[model samples]
Target: MIKFSGRGLLLDIEGTTASVAFVYDVMFPFVRRELDAYLQAAWKTPALEPVLRYIAQDAGADTFAAWTQDDATEQAKQQRVSAEITRLMDNDIKATGLKQLQGLIWKSGFDSGELVAAVFDDVPPALVRWNEAGKDVRIYSSGSVAAQKMFFGHTNHGDLLASFRGHYDTTTGPKKEAASYRVIASDYGCDASEILFLSDIVAELDAAREAGMQTGLCYRVGNAPVENGNGHPGIESFDQVSIG
Candidate 1:
């Protein structure tokens, strides 16, 4: 067990609170299957414009219009964006634009009861325990903030969104960077040492530790094996963590 006398808790989603398989097998496939239909439907809508601009910038273009300069028709531009999204997913690239688009797609699935987040059984009770103990709990994930909200709001164990104080995503900064953890600390309005960050990735934990936050390496089922925890405490479940 690990003991933390911290003001807040920062958590990672995939491979930490939820299984990696569920993301790769269920959520990602859902996005791939629905990508074309969703993109066509959302094109030209207010919500999709910013996301397309981001994707354009990610592709090294100044704007979506510039990116699709060769595409004379709306369908052509949409097809280009679709192709780019597919390429990104094929490589498992975690570009901000791709994540944002995936979140939008996921929102539809979640709202239509086609998708339900699969958090571990220990998660809900632990969230309640941490909240009751007066520790502020938040999430720092690569997924978009909107996706995180939808995910926690529609979990198999019921809505866990109320347990969180805030959410952070790639927009905050790369998870492997110490500066990101520092930014999170500032957002939490507390010293870096007053927050405990947990994740299944040792590099992320190392970054948090570098930022002076306590760190724990989670060992959840279906998570990629971590040969070296880099001296961080290992937690198989939230039950193993005692917050003061």
Candidate 2:
């Protein structure tokens, strides 16, 4: 059984609290398919420029050049940007643009019935129980905070975003890095010992443990470990957890 001694619960998406295949199959494919169109439409949007700048910087291209107006060379730039984006995605950098773009792209798939956010049947009840017990419940995912909101707000489960107290994204830090967990603990204004972090990935749980938080691995049905020698405790359902 997994134990929670914390004053709050910090859960991960795309594997721990949610289905991994849902993200890789539903979310990632949509991003890959519509990325070009999204960039074309959002090139001039004020909120998205920083993400463009990040792309330019990563590609070693000039960031000062105005990308608002597509020129003859725009396609070349987009190709380079696409390549750089692939690298960032492979490395799992929590770029805001990547997350925002994913949210926009996934929006279409979700609306078109191509995809739906998949949460385990037991998640909502456990979340409600956590809330009723006066324990804060938060989300920590590689997905941007906005994307996280959209996923929960429009899941097959329906509008479960209200069950959470807060959301965190890669902006908090790289999920694999221990310092990020420290930052999360600070953000929650609670001792790390009082925070339970649940995830399916051992590396993330290791980082959280280093930050002094408790951890549980949510081995949801149909999901299997991708790595060897993951020694952390694992859970098949939220029903297995005893949260006090």
Candidate 3:
């Protein structure tokens, strides 16, 4: 059994604490449909110019300023930009534009009643138990912090956002980067050994392991396996996680 010497818990959302289908079928499609409008509105916002410029740079736009132009060539460039942005999203890269775009698109879905973030039946109870036991429960997802909040804020199980002690996104760092877990362990003010990271993705587990944290595979039926060779623990559910 995988064990932790610390008091903090780092949990993943999709395919771990929550269902994979909720992210893949509902959230991803919702964002894909609303991407165009979201980009347009976000592009027009003066406050978001820096973020847009970052996206342009990430997407290989020749010049950041040129990316904001309204000419047909710029429009074509943005189309290519959008495609590349989608690709990064699919790979769960830590792109700021992708995060903002997801937040906007998810706003549409949340407002229209098209979807609700769903967690497993045991999640809420487990979260409550963990908290009552004085363990900090934090969320780490590729999705933006805003999207993460919206999900728990409007979950099928009701507003579970209150249960989370902290929220992290790609803004912290790419999920597969060992540095991100180090950042999180530091943020939690605990030794990496005291923090237990739960996720369905093996690569993320590997990264967390490299960062010196205890790791667990969520073991959802449809999700990928977390290889333990890199220092992650394997478990099927919160039920399998024993903290004494």
Better of 2 and 3 by lDDT: 3
lDDT per residue as tens, model 3, 200-244: 888898899899988887788677554453545567778777668
- Poorest 10 consecutive residues by lDDT, candidate 1: 220-229
Candidate 2 Cα outliers beyond 4 Å, as residue runs: 57-72, 87-97, 111-114, 226-231
Could you tally the backbone clashes for each prediction?
0, 1, 2
Which window of 10 residues has the lowest lDDT sum in candidate 3?
224-233
Full-model lDDT, candidate 1: 0.95
Compose the digit string of candidate 1's lDDT tens values, residues 129-192: 9999999999999999999999999999999999999999999999999999999999999999
Q: Estimate each model's TM-score.
A: 0.98, 0.87, 0.86
Clashing pairs in 1: none
Predicted structure 1: clash tally:
0
Residue-level error in angstroms, candidate 3, position 228? 7.0
The runs of at least 3 residues in candidate 1 whose Cα sits more than 4 Å from the true structure, single-residue gaps closed, are: none
User: What TM-score does model 3 achieve against the real structure?
Assistant: 0.86
- Pull out the clashing pairs in model 2: 6-194
